[model samples]
Target: MSDTLTTIGFDADDTLWHNERFFALTQSHFAELLADHTDHETLMQRLLEAERRNLPHYGFGIKGFTLSMIETAIEVTDGHAPASVIAEILNAGRDMLSHAVELLPHAAEAVEHLRRQYKVIVITKGDLLDQERKLAQSGLRDLFHGIEIVSAKTPEVYARIFNAYGTGADQGMMVGNAMASDVVPMIAAGGWGVHVPHGLSWEIEHAATPEHKRYHEIPDLAHLPKLIETLTQGQINATS
Candidate 1:
């Protein structure tokens, strides 16, 4: 919350709102459906690994994720499962597409508060249509002054966003849930980043721990505005 910074970028999905729960629920089904072949913990690990490997290839979103889950289930099951099992897995994928995305607690309040003082924008990755649909459905879409739908978050992504907002990295801040995808790259681009962890965040996101001096971690969205206020006040105190 640098008052000097006119623009603040926020990550969509799990950051500002709820996401990943669909994947988690689907995963539970995977474990149960394939109970004879794999346990929940092992299945979870494999799914996580598969997602990591698939990120580069699939970018982000439900389509690639669904495919990955199905692929992993088939691979781990070794083609021995009955056809009905595969059909059920496919059905689960369909159900995920229809699952509703929810806004995290205090998200709308934080966004409303921040928008009054900062140029709020959303930076997120995923399939274009689904991401767009979720945003429109989120009811918080209007709270953001702008929307950035990125296929992936990289150092370059941060650079572009900073440049677009006409601010240097130090003047900018990124709020996100995923340490690797949302915070790390933004921090590398010279911005302060806040991470709000979700209970069912994607595996790839949970792999990295928050350790950078510029990186701050919070339990959930309810504390985000307070953290931003603290950050902004700290900067003010140092300058004074």
Candidate 2:
């Protein structure tokens, strides 16, 4: 893996920082905003359905999620949702957008450690302006080789990013929290996928772990540097 992997990509949201928690908080607010119309459990289910239905149209991020909340509100309320409730949902989204970037444990340190020997970049999907703002506020931006705010993390997307960096799939690795977005696609692209499970993950991003030779799962970012070293040394042994 040492000789094969020259570029390492990180996922920005839940992988590097506390992102899904804010979304969970906002979802709680959204349920409250619509409580008069339906039960909390029912409303949550509807919101998840709405988000899934809207993913292709809106892609990923707070703006899209806010829109989904609005749509779900209208649907649950039979279009009688008051304008004030919509305003509150928008405010929730604004607050989320303005939320401070809280780096996860050892996120900065892991990136710093990896960058010394490999090309490191952030491959996150979200609103372009909002993603840029988060990256700027993250304070770890300077440690990355580049940032790619993508619409989706598909195999093609991984291929393109690896190619752009002058690396092949076998020569690139993706470290992230979402198996659907970060791990599976990169593995499909023939790259290594390192899954770092976060405390909270959006239901829309969940996928069953696949059995693959190049897939790895770690508890958190702190263990990443050691994992990389192990993989690198293993590759050295195989080639030697």
| Model 2 lDDT-worst window of ten | 1-10
lDDT at position 136, candidate 1: 88
| Model 1 agreement with the true structure over 1-240: per-residue lDDT tens digits | 334656778888877667777777777887888788888788878887888888789878887877777777887878676778878878987777767878878888888888888888888888788778888888988888778898888888888877786476567788887888878887788777888777766656654664777888888767877777887788788899
* Whole-model lDDT, model 1: 0.79
lDDT of 2 by residue, 127-193 (tens): 9988999999999989999889999999999999988974776789999999999999999998999
Estimate the TM-score for candidate 1. Answer: 0.88
Q: For each candidate, how many residue pairs have backbone atoms clashing (under 3 Å)? A: 0, 1
What are the Cα lDDT values of the candidates?
0.79, 0.90
Give Cα distance to truth, residue 20, candidate 2, Å. Answer: 0.4
By TM-score, who's the top model here?
Answer: 2
